[model samples]
Target: MTANANRLEVAGHSVLLTFGPGLETVAEEIDALWYHLRAADDDGATPQIRLDYALPSGDLPAGAVPLPARPEASYTISGHLTREVIRRLIGTRLLLHAGAVAHPELGILVLVGASGAGKSTASSMLGRGGAYLTDELTIITPGTFALTPYPKPVSKHDPELGAKRDLALGGLGLRPAHEAAAPAPAMVLLLERIRDEDEPEEGSSVTRVPLSEALTRIVPQTSSLWALPGGLATLAELLNSVGGALEVRYREAAELEELLRRLPPAEHAETAEIEPRPGDVVTWEDTAPAPGRIAAVPFRQALAMESGLFLLGEHGAIHLPGLAGLVWDLLADAGPLTFDQLEQLVVEEIGEHPESTALVRGTVSDLVAHGWARRG
Candidate 1:
């Protein structure tokens, strides 16, 4: 550690930021953003990650990672630090690009969406009343539903500065996670912003969504899905425990207060493994297959939801929605069945169709081509 070193506790990991010569200004900017997490310099324990900014000799310091060169070195270092932390913890936790706030009684409500979807804005505004867990990344411990806060400064794009500025949470008058009540995973909300200039009277609303539809949208927002073993199954179980996911359509963050406050506490159901029932029917109205034996690719694993299924194959995780999901469940459960037998099962589930012959053939062909199933 050097005289210019500043240590920060980031998501339970210790990171030491050692400033290089002529980087005093960059250090100040970083200090402003993470001052809350700064560790006392007297501690002598080595940090898990030690990064150096703008080394004058253009070479990295011994045992330290050199940050990428950028005009805004402060921002570059912040991004690098966040990525490094995520890289180390990817397989151990489920990381979503969502914002989180904790209610005293209702527990934690996670606001999930893609970038520019106003999750950060919503979290920031809601945090004024609830405990702020995070505004950028929401880290969930699988099965337990415990949250690990990565409360980095909220980055807002500044038109005058021509770059995004990281604003400290304290400066905005919001409560940080440590200062708030202990919270547990309670609800997951899919944020959809409805912008209609002509419909000025429109207000925000929250509605319950089916498991399959929520899985389709929420899976892509996760950064650790591919790395975590049985990730889809874990997520499916979590959704079930919290009484499935909800969709919240809103025009602005300010309008959500009354709606959120009036919402009932999440119903905690018995933890159940996500598997298809014997008599489950998929009414997605898609056709089935004919003739030869069909079996799923070897070593493939899958988890079924209400109307969708996730297949983890040699390629990656695949979302089989609607009719496609039904077909997958059949193959995974009782594969190597004759196409006629498969067709019989499909008929039993959704009844036989006049055009099922060709359509089933097409669906089977697609599965074989995509490495999900093969002719036996």
Candidate 2:
């Protein structure tokens, strides 16, 4: 490979970056973080996210995010690249901004929270004897919602406390976590805090939340849920499979590792199979038999994920999945369309299946009933 080009693969996506000739420091730092998982040697498959990093060159490449001249700028550029890739893949994959570790027998455990909420700290500490899936982004496969591990370099900011350098999985006395060919999450924990200075003697606490509430809380934690096809419905399915969530408010990040041991054993239901396709719509045939004209309800934001859709505004939030997502996209474009327009488009996209029109009609009725959409 030439000095100008580098490749890193994560979560079934490949990122290839071609840098300007003089940018050796930038390339080295980014590569140190991901080169172990490089696709440079893999059979030549097209990359999903390809970027050209130029150093204030006369003209920028067609789709490249321009790089900074400062050597330290490399770190920021790498982060931006990761975010862009995650955003691009949101519709195809269920990507969450979270952390994960695998158990000897129970399978994968997930940690989720807002940035600076100690997700990385907890994930790094939990990696000592467990598999480190990721400390930043966790990607869930469509339909089955199986989590595919993508362990990125762990960032250590508190050098006075520990290793200040950003290091790969093995750098912290842990091996890279093997990606789950068929992941079945054992547990999902939301990392909360009781106090900043709570000591181990103070002890930690775990609280259980209803699946509905857990689903609501987790939706916002996702990196790009707005871009997902049926995002909300997809998340709801995932939470239902897990039963619910356990809120872990602890004194130290290390406490999470032990919490895993004390928690109840993984249940067969936790890994039970779920609907595994993004565009698959729930059957609404009986709920609202009559179809109506469909229109987009203006909102602060509205989007469709792989299997769900949502709209938010000062008034409130309303989300849907199954056929609702398909309906939302159809109306979102040009205000409202007739039933014929929806059926025609649906048929064109998914084929002239008998249930397509009925599904769209049922979905529209639900939207109208909820006042999230209008029908005429």
Candidate 3:
């Protein structure tokens, strides 16, 4: 029961962590980790966490803070200690509460779902033959998905499964999840447990669904979004980037692994090209445009829409087709100019037409509302 210190690198950040005395004694038997993390503010508070060890630790500096003292032993399935560690480690990087696994020949699959959806079981099952990216959370950025493996400890469970897999309970210090860089998830799987009657026979089955529904189910599973500043906007961007949804259901771990191995790798489709000319209709209400077509640009705290030639606002574009072209040109030229600057630019470029000024202001307002551009 000696106290021990360990470090795990997740999402390109190094996290200095420590476990309570003798905590490692029970590590291998279960599927979770227990420890107390020092507060980021150095406020002498401890926040718990169930984290991965494989995440990058380079971002965490050494001796940042000492691990907090452990509480008196009590019977519990799992416990954790965290601070602003996860958010600070990744910054604005795309974070997901999903398990990431990779195979030498089979590629990578991201298992996304709420806790108790079999992510740990599935990851452990797959890691028997392939590489385990992470059993909990993963961070993704443009063109890369980094696995921040939190190596806490595993708990006791089904004897048959544990024995069959040779899983034992004992503290082995933290270990990285993957040896090589993790590729972006070709397929994002939302895992769901099958009811007795609904269980699929011998293989994993995948089905596609709308992106909205997928985001709805997947967002809540993310370990700590609310804790991160401006996390909601970041999450929305991530959902938009993934583009679609998928559901995976299976009965047995082996069956699911086999199914994943047999399936083709998932690919992100290129954004569809938008036609230049406007014809019959021209508003959000007319017909829903595809994502990226008219994204709500966030300016400061307001929202607006950038629709082709016109920067439509809640009111209307200043010059409609003619003036809209000028607005776009201004935005392109100025490069993320603020609303005040944009208004001034409009006056400079098109001169002082009251109706035109009103129109431009309206369009800018709308674009901000939709999150196409920001004030700063």
Give the TM-score of each candidate: 0.79, 0.65, 0.48
Over 2-74, each residue of candidate 1 has an lDDT whose tens digit, in order, gives 4377788888888988776667777877887788777667478989977766554546567655544344566
Q: Which stretches of candidate 2 lie over 4 Å from their true place?
A: 1-3, 40-46, 57-64, 69-74, 158-165, 180-182, 197-203, 226-229, 264-376
Q: Model 3, 301-334: lDDT tens per residue?
A: 1111132232322332221235554665566445
lDDT of 3 at 336: 55
- Cα lDDT of all candidates, in order? 0.71, 0.66, 0.47
- Work out how many backbone clashes candidate 2 has: 15
For model 3, the local distance difference test gives 0.47
Residues 88-198 of candidate 2: C-alpha lDDT, one tens digit per residue: 776688778788877665467788887657887888877677677788788887688777777777765655644234566667766667554447676788888657455
Best-to-worst order by lDDT is 1, 2, 3
Q: For candidate 3, give the lDDT of residue 119.
A: 79
TM-score of 2: 0.65
**After superposition, which runs of candidate 1 have C-alpha atoms over 4 Å from their true positions?**
1-3, 55-72, 104-106, 179-181, 197-202, 264-301, 312-318, 333-352, 365-376
User: lDDT of candidate 1?
Assistant: 0.71
Higher-TM-score candidate of 2 and 3: 2
> Model 3, which residues run further than 4 Å from truth?
1-84, 146-180, 197-204, 223-243, 261-376
